[model samples]
Target: LTVTMRQRPSFVVVGEVRGAEAFTVFQAMSIGRYVFATFHADDIETFIHRMESKPINIPRNLMLTLDVVIILSNLSSDRGSLRRIKTVSEITGQDQLTSEIVVNNAFTWNSVTDTNPYSGFSYVLKRIAEKEGKFEADLEKEVDIRSKILDKMIEKQITNYKEFYNLVNLFYKDRVRLFETLDMTEEVLM
Candidate 1:
C-alpha cells in the first residue's frame, strides 16, 4: 500500500468501503491522506450495521479514524424552507457504554434557539478557526461580518434560512456583485 502511494495517483478516492477496506482506509487517513466520501446513513448506528454485517467486515475500532461526516437531508415540504439541509459532523471517538460516537461539540445546531436566519453560524466559524489555529481573530471577525450582513439582510426583509443561506453563498461567491447590488459600504465588508 505504501509503495502504491509513491505514484500518487491522479486522486485516490475510496468509494464507501464497508469491510476490511475500512481498516486500510483508516490507516491511510491516519497517515495524513485525504478522503472525500459519503455514507449511506446519517448517524452512527447505520455505520455499525454496515460494518458488522458487510462483505468488507469492518472492525469497530477502525471507525474511530473518521474525522468528518456531512449529513444532507431533504425537507420534502411544499412550504420550501431549508430544502438543502447540510449538517456537518466530526467524529471525536467512541462512548463508553453505548460505544457510539462522541461528537466534540466543535459546532452544532439548536433547533430552539436558531429561530433567526443568522444563527449558530458563529459556532461553525469558531470550529473552522479552531481547526486552522486562527482562533484569535477569525472567529470574532466572522461574527462581526455576519452580524453586519444580518442587519442588512433584515433591512432587506430576508427572513427564511434558505434565502439567507443563498444570499450568504452568493455574497461570498461574487463579492463584487453583492457589493454593487446591495450597495454595501466599505466599512461593513472590510
Candidate 2:
C-alpha cells in the first residue's frame, strides 16, 4: 500500500495507525501528501502521548505537518447516548523543547452550556488563509457560507452520502446553479 501510494497517489487512507507503518503515514504527510488514519485514543492529549510512545514513536518533526485532530466520544446525556466530536485540535508545530508537538486550541463542545456547538478560534482557518493568500476574515466568511450550505442540506433532508458530495462539488463548479437549487442567494455565499 505504501509503495503504490508513494508512486503518484493524491492521498492515502489507513484504517488505523499502529506498529511500524505509523512512521510511513507521517512520512507521507511530510512530503506534501494527505494521509488520513484513525488512532485509538480518548482525546487529543492521549492521542499525542500515544504517538510519542513505544511501537508507534512518530517523530515530533513529522507531527508538525498534521493539520487537525478530531476527538470523538460517546456521551450519555438526558437525550440519550450520542456520539459526537468532543474537541478539535490544530497542530501548529513542535515545541522548542523538541519534546512534544504544539497544538492550538481550535474548538470544543461544552455539554453543560451547549451555547454553541463549537467554541474558540481555529488555527486551521488561519493556515488556510495563509495558503490561499486571503485574509483570515475572508476565510471565516467562506466557512460561514459552507456551514449555511450544510444547514440547508439537512433542512431539505438531503441525507444520501453521494448526493451530498455531488451537490457540494456542483456548488464548487457552478455556484449560481447550486445557489438557485438550494434556494440560497448567491450574495449569501459572498
- Pairs clashing in candidate 1? 19-56, 19-57, 20-56
Candidate maximizing lDDT: 2
Alpha-carbon lDDT, every model: 0.61, 0.80
**lDDT by residue for model 2 (1-190), tens:** 6786649687988997778888888888888888888888998889988887898998777777789988888888889988877778888776777556777766777777752254447778877789889998887777778878887898899999999999989988997788888898865746
User: Which portions of model 2 miss their true places by more than 4 Å?
Assistant: 113-120, 186-190
The clash count for each model shown is 3, 0
Question: Each prediction's TM-score against the native?
Answer: 0.53, 0.86
The best candidate by TM-score is 2
Model 1 stretches with alpha carbons more than 4 Å out:
1-6, 9-23, 79-83, 96-98, 104-133, 136-190
Among residues 3 or more apart in sequence or in different chains, the pairs in candidate 2 whose N, CA or C atoms overlap within 3 Å are none
Error of 1 at 85 (Å): 2.9
